[model samples]
Target: MTIPLVRVHGVDDVRLDNIDKPRTAPGDVLIEVLLCGICGSDLGYIGMGGLGMTHPMPLGHELVGSVAEVGERVSHLQIGDRVVVNPMAGGNSIGNGGTEGAFSPYLLVRNVAADERAVIKIPDGLSVDQAAMVEPLSVALHGCRQGNAKAGDKVVIFGAGPIGLCVALCLNYLGVERLVIVDQSSHRLAAAESIGAVPFKAGSNNLGEFLIQQHGQSELMGMPVPSSDIYIEATGAKPVFEQIMNTAKTGARVVVLGLHKQSVPLDLANVLLRELNIVGSMAYSDEFPAVIEMLTGGKIDLQPIISHRFPLSQFSEAIAQASEPDEAIKVLIDCQC
Candidate 1:
């Protein structure tokens, strides 16, 4: 049968064309995608070409799908079972700096003998769109887990993008009392506020001073205390790293969740003398189930985030729509159409 899934034919070029539906490999399952969320990595690779891509590539990882077929060795799943595919698995390869996890239309989790380990079951009642959010939410959850949030702790999340907002929401779930989100985009900052976090514009002259005066009260060592007990950096901006350091109170913990190409300066002294703990969070480990439960329990604002949708045939248009200001928080492609 002809399968309809979007493919990145070239840099900045996505085309929707009829391709053969997949069949199960030795340890594989063919999934009909239900929903998919485009990620910044996808955009970056598509716009830059082969920079973070493997040849014979597909570019979506945040997704919900159902088993169309299962291989003889795949006993845990069967046809028609809905699932969220976690293509980000562990293996060493050239693309993506020797990582085996992936984003694709139909993913194959090759094992030791070209085996597979990329499928995770999804719960009922959670929409496909929400399932598509699992990866990003998992990223947020992973970072918050590293922060070790405690009740009454404060968290400052930089970048009001989906990742940032997800971090804030996850922090709320983790019992943080004071959640501060920093973003320069009025649209995204408004999103952070809509979800009950106090939003501040980054890059403002008075940004640090404003936060210090309002929330920097607890004195860890007479260092004007701290505002965010945990600071989550999600903007990936080089300068925001400096801001995260300057704004953090004594003995604060910082988690870096953003991705950028250039290296930024660091303050090892502050981290040393003040007992600041700086941690870097990569993707996720095994947090999809909890994220799905969070979605089912109404802990996240996902529907409003999915501001745009398009038929698979209009893939180019969908990408264009996602690029505009006040644009899509999540954009989906209806592959069956």
Candidate 2:
């Protein structure tokens, strides 16, 4: 049977074309894609047009699939095995295993060794859509690891988007004493509160004064809020990034997990004055294997993140959902259709 694929042929358009099903190349594996989660980078590529990202490329990096065929040289993966693609597979950074980008109905594993390389198998009870989120979830995990959140440290996240929420979720698992999530969106802030974090709605005139007067205490968490020992900036907006820089407490570790516009102004005196240590987290390392384990082990519940799904034919519709404010988080495309 000829497998149909939805390919991005241009800057802002996609085409549904019938392409031949991939064959089992010497060292490659053919996968039947189950679900591909829409990521922030995907929209950046589309919305930025030519300047936003590279052209004539598949945009998705968060993906999951099942093995349809495996090459003779491929020893580990066989036909009918469920799997998920790791985006860092080809990078020098960690967690860069598996295929290039898995956005099509079928994808090809590249020139890496199969036995020691390629995607990880999904255990029973983990749905394909949940498996698809391993990429972003790994990002959150890396942020948590970088922040070094201990059992009783105060952690504050700047954004309540998928990445921020994921970081909050993982930090809770790490036994952090208090999780303070800062966001401007009422909806996103509410969602953060639902998952054990004391949600702070920023963008208010009296936000700083209110927090100061109350002494960072939250009735929801039933305790005096700890000073932010570590801060994770998940939203890269210029003003928001500035707010994060100015507001971080002295002698704290700040991890920049969000992607910003081009660049922004920074107060050098603050860093020098406070002895703040700042670091930039590019992408995932070899964290997908652990993410797969976390998913299968049920350490984190990803169900809340995946708020919408669409068939492959509605690629445009799926991408559009990402910008809608009322839509919860992480809309996915079911490639099986």
Best by TM-score: 1
TM-score of 1: 0.88
Measured on C-alpha atoms, candidate 2 has an lDDT of 0.70
Residue ranges of candidate 2 with Cα displaced over 4 Å: 50-55, 91-101, 112-117, 209-226
**Per-residue lDDT over 152-210 for candidate 1, one digit per residue giving the tens place of the 0 to 100 score:** 88778888777888887788787776888888778877777887788887666576666
Q: Lowest lDDT 10-mer window, candidate 2?
A: 90-99
Put down candidate 2 lDDT per residue, 157-209, tens digits, no spaces.
Answer: 88888889888878877788477888877878778888888878776665444
lDDT score, residue 258, model 1? 91
TM-score of every model versus the real structure? 0.88, 0.86
